[model samples]
Target: AQSVTQLDSHVSVSEGTPVLLRCNYSSSYSPSLFWYVQHPNKGLQLLLKYTSAATLVKGINGFEAEFKKSETSFHLTKPSAHMSDAAEYFCVVSRNTDKLIFGTGTRLQVFP
Candidate 1:
C-alpha cells in the first residue's frame, strides 16, 4: 500500500516570497507522485507529477517538486507567491493504477 502525509496543514507567504509545502510518502513499490492544486469554487488541477523519469518535475504556475528517494520526500516549491495562488494543495500517490491516495491537504494563504 502507498500513502502520503502532508507535514503542514497550512502555509502562509508574502506575495513575492517563496512557497514550500512539505510531503512525505510511503510505498511498497515505485510509485507515481503528484501535486494538485484547487482554488476557491474550482476543481483540482494538476500542478506537477513524478513518474520515475526525472527527480525534478516542473508544473504550472512556477511550481515544481523534486523526488528524493533517499529522503522519501516530494516537496513542492515556488520561487515566488501570488495572491491568486492562495488555495488548497494535495499530495497524492498512485501505483500506476486508477486509485489515488490523497493527503489531508494544505491550505496556502498568500498575503500582500
Candidate 2:
C-alpha cells in the first residue's frame, strides 16, 4: 500500500519570500517519493524525487525535499518564492508496480 497526504490545501506567501509545503506518506513496499508542480492548466513537472539511494533530494526551480523514513514524511521547501512559483503542487508516491498515486493538491498563492 502506498499513500501520500499533503497537509495543506492552500498556502499563501509574499513574493520574494520563502516557501514551504508539507507532505507525509506511508508505504508498505520500499518507497519512491516525488514532488511535482503544475502551473495553471499545465502538465505536471518533476520537482524532486527520493529513491532508496538518496534521502536528501534536490529539485528544479530552487526547490528541495528530504525523505524521512521514521516520520514517513517528505516535505518540500524553498528559500525564496518567485511569482512563477504560485501554482499547484502534488506529492506523489510510487507503488511497487510502477504506478504513481498523487495527493489531492496544494495551491500556492504568491502576493506581490
Candidate 3:
C-alpha cells in the first residue's frame, strides 16, 4: 500500500519569491511519486514525477522535487512564485497500478 501526506493545507507566498510545498509518503514497495496541480474547475495536470530513476526531478513551471528514500519525503519547490502559480497541488503515490493515492491537497496563494 502507498500513502501520501501534504503537511500544509495552504501555502501563501509573495509574487517572485520562492515557493515550497512539503510532502511525505509511505509505501510497502518502491513507489512512483508525482505532483499534480489543478486550477479552479479544471482538470488536473502533471507537474513532475519520480520513478526510482533520479533523486532530483524537475517539473513544469520551474517546479522540482527531490525523492528522498531514507526520509520518505518528496517536497515540491519553485524558484520564483507567480500569480498564475496559485492553485491546488496534490502529492500522489502508486506502486505498479494506475490507481494513485492522493493527498488532501495544498492550496497555494500568491500575493503581490
Candidate 4:
C-alpha cells in the first residue's frame, strides 16, 4: 500500500517570505507524487507532480519540490509568498495504476 504524511498541519508565513511545507511517504512500489492546493470551499488544483521524472520538479506560481528517495521525502518550497497563496495544501502519492493517497492537509496562513 502507498501512503502520504504531511508533517505540518498548519503553516503561517509572512508576505514576501519563503514558504515550506514538509511531506513524507511510504510506498511498496515506485510512486508518483503530487502537490495540490485548495481554496476555501473550492476544488483542488494540481500544483506540481513527480512521476519518475526529475528529482527537482517545478510547479506553477514559483513553487517547487524536490523528491529525495534516500530520505523518503518530498518537501515543497517557494521563494516568495503571497496572500493569494494562503490555502490548504495536500501531499499525494500513488502508483502508476493505483489510486491516490492524500495527506491530512496543511493549511497556510499568510499575513501581511
Local distance difference test, per candidate? 0.97, 0.93, 0.96, 0.96
- Cα lDDT of model 1 by residue, 1-112, tens digit: 8899999999999999999999999998999999999998999999999999989999999999999999999999999999999999999999887699999999999999
Checking candidate 1 for backbone clashes, the offending pairs are none
lDDT of 2 by residue, 1-112 (tens): 7899999999999988889899999888778999999999999999998888778889999999998889999999999999999999999999556989999989999999
Backbone clash total for model 1 is 0
Separate clash counts for every candidate: 0, 0, 0, 0
Window of ten residues with lowest summed lDDT in model 4 = 92-101
Better of 1 and 2 by TM-score: 1
Q: Kindly report which residue stretches of model 2 are placed more than 4 angstroms away from their true locations once superposed.
A: none
TM-scores of the models, in the order given: 0.98, 0.95, 0.97, 0.98
User: Candidate 3, which segments miss by more than 4 Å at Cα?
Assistant: none
Clashes in candidate 2: how many? 0
What is the TM-score (0 to 1) of candidate 1?
0.98
TM-score of 3: 0.97
Instruction: Give the C-alpha miss distance for residue 103 in model 3, angstroms.
Output: 0.3
